[model samples]
Target: MDNSNMWIKHKNNRSIKEQVDILVKLTETHKKCIGLPKSKREVEFLKILYPASIRNLEIGDKFIGKTDYSAVGFGCVTSTSGVGYFFHKHKIDELKNNTKDKELLEKINLVEKYWCDKDTQENFRKELKKSNPEFFKKFAKNDNYSCVVCGFSRLSGMQLNYNKLLDLGVNGLKKSILSRNKDGKNDFYRASLEALDLFLDIANHFEIETRKLAQSLIGDKLEREEVLKVSNCLKEIKKGEKPKSFREAIQLTWLYGVVAGVVNYGRMDDYLGEYLLDDLNNDKLTEKEALDLVKSFWKMIAWRKTVMNGRVTIGGKGRRNEKAADKFAMIAMEATRINKDLEPQLTLRIYENQNKKLLEKGLEVISEGCTFPMIYNDEVNIPSVASAMNVSLKEAEDYVPFGCGEIILCGKSVGTPNVLINTLKALEVTLRNGYDRVNDVSLGYNTGKIEDFDTFDKLLEAYKTQLKIHIEELAKAQRLSYDVMKENCSFIYVSLLIDDCIEKGKELLSGGARHLGGTLEVYGNINSANSLTAIKKIVFEDEKINLKQLVHILDRNFNGFEEIRNELLNAPKYGNDEAEGDLMASKLHEYVCMCIKESAKDIGLDSFLAVVINNHSNTIWGRTTLASADGRKKGQFMANGNNPYNGTDINGPTAMLNSLTKLKTDIHAGSVQNMKFSRSMFKNHINIINQLLEVYFENGGSQLMITVVDPKELEKAYNNPTNYRNLIVRVGGFSARFVELDRQVQKEVMERTLYE
Candidate 1:
């Protein structure tokens, strides 16, 4: 991956330097607008953005915005240099001081009022509430206070229809776009053409700009040579043809993503690998140059400054063009080693026959504690996703992991986690006859008191009933909200890129995707399971405490009952691989999955599955949950994503792994497993760690999100934030600076047993 001579020649070149300068200028300019009042600034901002989206696809005389081989595009409508997406009103206060330009701000407010608003998917919530007040009221019955009940936010991240881009090429897509603009065209056709035309216009803008910049660089020997290369790449795309060079292919890919606001690059090695191999074979580019371009692109991806960086997945089954994908995957690994930036989160998919060197490289990256390239097991996920999505093995091969580890078919499905349900809260309601002690309300259905249940199975049955009702009500709410979005706030650009949309002549939101599903994020799994086990053992089986006494202790938040709380905590816990606790976990997981599947069918959805990847919501949900029979005090953060409650996984890492594999992952979309290893353990017992992972995946573990850090170092960082400014740790689905997390999150990280 090294070519020092090539680097020397291009290192001091003017074209590349100028491109960086332009990007930096644009980024700086965009940063200043962040603090401006949203109402005033939104209109002024959109006025500029509307034309940029519709027009500004051409190149400038300078090479700043022109990069034919780069992985990311410049000049997004909302943010210049692709620093971030459109700003939301709530983010205006990150500023330490107010902007002094009063008159300008006022003018911005006035201009914004006249501009037509682009309705986001979030608008559907308001519309759904307006149309069906009863549905919203049902979920919002607890005065919109409980994370268990009031979890109704529907947000989705995307993986572009790269198959369209890679297989059809720019020209082929243009033919489809143009065919739609006939007289008397339906709204779907008209909107699809409008969106596709805007895309082409954007392509032409970059092409023209690149050509002009190349022409201006004449007589400047080295820079002119480089600029013309860029110009040729752009001209190829402008002609609506497939990319003739690796550079042109990458440019087309980035620009399309920019226009569509789709960040995750679905199986890049599969899509772009063929062009790269062709270029290498034809002596058009060297490995070093390709590696350099990838690194540059990696930098662009990191610039977005969003929570989930654009995921560029490499090496998965069902990849159409597997030509030089392995070579590119290796190069991508090397590029991450060089760039060391947090995102373009390079995720590598591994199976039994995957290149061993690639796995070794991924381990090396993890060893360096960069927290990426995140590994996914095709052996487990392929089958798991196939079953959950009810798709064929070949179709399931297109499954891509989105933000926080939810699986959605890349070009074929829309499976967003639209609502969150707290299983632990259901347990609480079951115990107290439908009363929510924490929120001081009656939120769930009254199923009689725990004392009335003669057997533990009866108590479990009551809890199951509550879960089914909650899931049914929530699923209906989400389906209705999505229908409103489909009817009114159509995602035109997104529709044009996703599959079956153009084929059906309908929007992706409007049943155009091959599979339409909603994911319910079920948080506090281990917490609830452990609580049920404790109650079953101590109260019903052992008779260490009567049912009435246990209820009294729980209601008092476990105060003045330290001895009983200890007894409850000492009861067999999950993550210990004990049969008693593991059996309970299995039963609870089975019940949740059963309810989710039934609710999906009841609500007329193609698929609905549970995702236990509760990114930071474990803590949020804990805020509204009362003390449990597991001896957990009220308001304490719940367990983190199928992980055991804090300090409760008394057994070692292997036992914990075994316990996690107890759940039925095939019936679910995805779940996150967070495990921490001490630096010494990871470094010393690397082979053991590798074998453990292989066994876990082979045994049907869905996803493993590991955070390797020394407990001492983490504690130090938490105590002295300024000393370890760059220390990062994986929290659920994403990684962040260790010191920047909330105090409880930081504590949670510290509490995770550092395997040694």
Candidate 2:
């Protein structure tokens, strides 16, 4: 029985009256779906909303999906938005305040009354808080920084198995589900089938839109041809047939991923390689044409605007077709070179005895000020990931770095960096005996104060104890979140796409994923390490300043303590390739990684580790973090990711890169090493840049994200934004136009050493 025509007709450009009618219908549908299984109820919601939500195909849009895609998946906060369907209370109130349309406001109120406390976030929080109050209390009390940031929503930060979707197509997926569910009575299977039906129906809508747009633009040959191509690709996929061309493959991948609310597209070249090669060999489309389609795909990606989340991988070992994959990778690099967009965070994975031209092209793009094609060293990462995730090297080969730089085993793992731990704050709380002076609360466990720790080693151990207490609590919150979400939403969409979900006949969070692991995001690691190194050198070794005296000076944020601050600043810094400082950082890194990893079994997780994958949160969190013993002022940004504190790496780029490789990454999920090179120096010297990266990676560097900018150009743009509209810089894990970044983020970027 075909259920595609069961939903009502969609009116995207609806007036106030149409929206009200749709909301009323959804309210009625919600009442009808009350007793059904949770997965089936979710499908019931989408069955109505999918057709009624927005749909349009731009004149030159090569990809079918748009920025305003009414996409949904297993998410906590994303229970509903748009069309005024299931709009949470907060959104409803905001809409009423912002809109002048009285009819729209009435509809919003009606939806809010019907679904005020029924949203996923509200329900998930209510249940999980009962189990993990300490983690929830921080958020409830509005303390954004208590050395840890956690929530019950653990759905984001996962990589969907797009390769499985592309390989199976629509019909194959449905067939597999049916085979698993022989009786056809399973709610997960039923919900999955219904979701597929919605997927097809949505594709049909885009096809019709594309056809109409093609007809209207018949006079313009170029644009008409593009939409028509998209129309044909949509027609093929919606009919459940395998894609025979590259355009068909890309169209299916984008439309499905966008509609499924999946941001990360892992190992694109590995999965889409065969179709790309097949199309090129058969002359179905020119190389330029395929590249244009990818550009359109990038357009849709940038349109989503998932800041620091859209990760696309290419060029690594273990590819079934390395030749085709490499070819696709070169094209992807070219696309990054041409598009100059912030998204899809094009990543290139290089290994031993592989092509170096790809690296040169990536550098060339970076020199053009496109902070993209972030480099990953397979030689270092593969072995490191195998140890970190506790998987075989074969499984680790499927490693894909999702949001920021947290690594998950591509399609097989559920590794979301669910909590953000502030290592520096751990030290701060230990120094003050569990008091968070900045927030004026007892945030961490009451470890002994500075006076009790007569030796530096004792102080460091106390700090570690504080970190462990907070990590276990926050980690328990993460685990309980998964357990709670499993009872409410089946995560059916991802279950269909994620590996072993169908085989296990269970949802993603219900023991379906191969590796049901979690990650904790650790920030201020280098700053904390620097503080320890500085204290070890200036206070303990020299005995010039006692621990209590130093804590007092730090409490004042270095006020009237200029001489002691200078002494701390003059101490050995990590990024200078100094052994004493780097070794301290190494010790702290191993402790945090092993601590988190070892707690996985106790927390009921397969594997839980730390990811120093810093985002803009580093700047935001640093603003509230108190001053430290490392000579940093209070409320100032800490070091971004594993890089040294800004302006501290004076010995230059090579030394900094050398120091970055010192910390072992094998036991942790992932880390980011950001470097900024002066455009004037490296732009004309691509060969030297190539050799430099080669030596760095060969010397055990795991990953690097480089930004090549002209000397003083960031200052030029920051001062006069209108002058440099296209000045892009690497901001932690993502790149953004310098003029568009938040001012503090801009300041942090400006402060990094621009090696010239």
Candidate with maximal lDDT? 2
Tens digit of per-residue lDDT, candidate 2, span 1-756: 001111222223555555556666777787798899988887887676665654577666677665332212123223112211224343345446666887777767777677766655456568656766765665443234534454435465556777778778888998998888898888788889989988898888878878888899868998888778888888888897677888888888877766556678889998888889998999887899889878878877876566667889998888889888888888888888899988879998988867777777777777887888898988889999998888999989989887778888887888866566778877887889988787788776788967888888898889888888877776786686576667666766767778888888778888788889988888888999999999887888999899999989999999999999999988888899989888898999988888888999998888999888777767877887888888898988889889999999988888999999889988899898898888777877767777788789889999999898888889999999999998888888777888988899899999998878
Candidate 1 deviation (Cα RMSD): 8.1
Looking at candidate 2, what is the lDDT of residue 688? Answer: 76
- TM-score, candidate 1, is 0.84
RMSD after Cα superposition, model 2 = 4.7
lDDT of 1 by residue, 1-756 (tens): 000111111121133333333323333443455464322232233223432433222221212222221111222221122211222232122111233456534433332332213223235456656865754654654333373565433336567787687677755765675676456355666555445555555556666765676677677767766666666666676666777777877877876675555656788888788888998999988999888777866766665544543677888787766658888888898988777766776778888877788888887877777777778889888888888888898889988887777788887888777677888888888888887766576777888786788788888888888888788877877687576455433455666678887777676767677788888878887889999899889988999887778888898988899999998999888898889988988888888987787688887788989887866667666777889988888878888878877788888887888988898878888777888887887888899999998888787776677677875999899889999888878877666778878888788778877787
Runs with alpha carbons beyond 4 Å of true place in candidate 2: 1-24, 67-90, 98-104, 139-143, 146-148
Worst 10 residues of 1 by lDDT: 1-10
Query: Model 1 Cα displacement at 506 (Å)?
Result: 1.5
> Candidate 2: worst 10 consecutive residues by lDDT?
1-10
What's the TM for model 2?
Answer: 0.94
Record all residue pairs in model 1 with backbone atoms less than 3 Å apart, i.e. clashing.
Answer: 19-64, 40-109, 43-112, 57-205, 57-206, 58-205, 58-206, 59-209, 171-240
TM-score of each: 0.84, 0.94
lDDT for model 2 comes to: 0.78
